[model samples]
Target: MLFEDEKTNSEIAKMLHIGETTFYKWKNNPKFIKAQHEYAVYQFDSALPLAVKTLIEILKYGKSDKVRLQAAQIIFKRAGLFSDNGNPELDKAKQRKAIA
Candidate 1:
């Protein structure tokens, strides 16, 4: 509900017919955590640059290449580079395999 009109926590709780306590509890749920994380990214503001940077670092150094790629995609999209026409560099990179 944060997107439609940027509803607050209380508003969301009322809309979902739940108490504030219940809503807080839901915040700790794994599914809710994932959704909230995405929502936070979508609604991110300039003041959140540090948090974004931290996430990028985690993605860059994290164990999973998949996670790192996902983070890179998010960062690129947020920076307005990933467009409807797609990214040429990304396409080319995907077509080429690294020799290790």
Candidate 2:
């Protein structure tokens, strides 16, 4: 139900009859963040726009490359197949050669 048409935290809080502060506290919990990330990916695969919104939400609070990688993977998987030719992960040297 997290991916329902109304996906904002405020909207969810209202639907669940919880205060915004409670919702924020829940979102800050590690367990809740992990679960929410997984649910967001599932919703993304189901073509829910809220999934993308959720990913962005998670990214905003993420503090590590691991989290960013997870977000990137979700985006890549949903967008299309990728190849090394245009890989954005490459170093500057690789990018210059590719550009040349």
Candidate with best lDDT: 1
Q: Please write out the lDDT profile of model 1 over residues 1-100, one tens digit for every residue.
A: 6445598889999999999999889978899889977877766764488878787797779677666666776777788986536477865565343211
Off by over 4 Å in 1: 1-47, 84-100
Which regions in candidate 2 have their CA more than 4 angstroms from the true location?
1-7, 44-83, 86-100
Across 1-100, the per-residue lDDT of candidate 2 in tens digits comes to 5545558888889988999999889879999989988988876678767767879877666777566555765676667754435445564454355335
RMSD in order of candidates: 11.0, 12.1
Candidate 1 local Cα displacement, residue 89, angstroms = 19
Worst-scoring 10-residue span by lDDT in model 1: 91-100
Local distance difference test, candidate 1: 0.73
lDDT of each: 0.73, 0.71
**Sequence-dependent TM-score of model 1:** 0.37
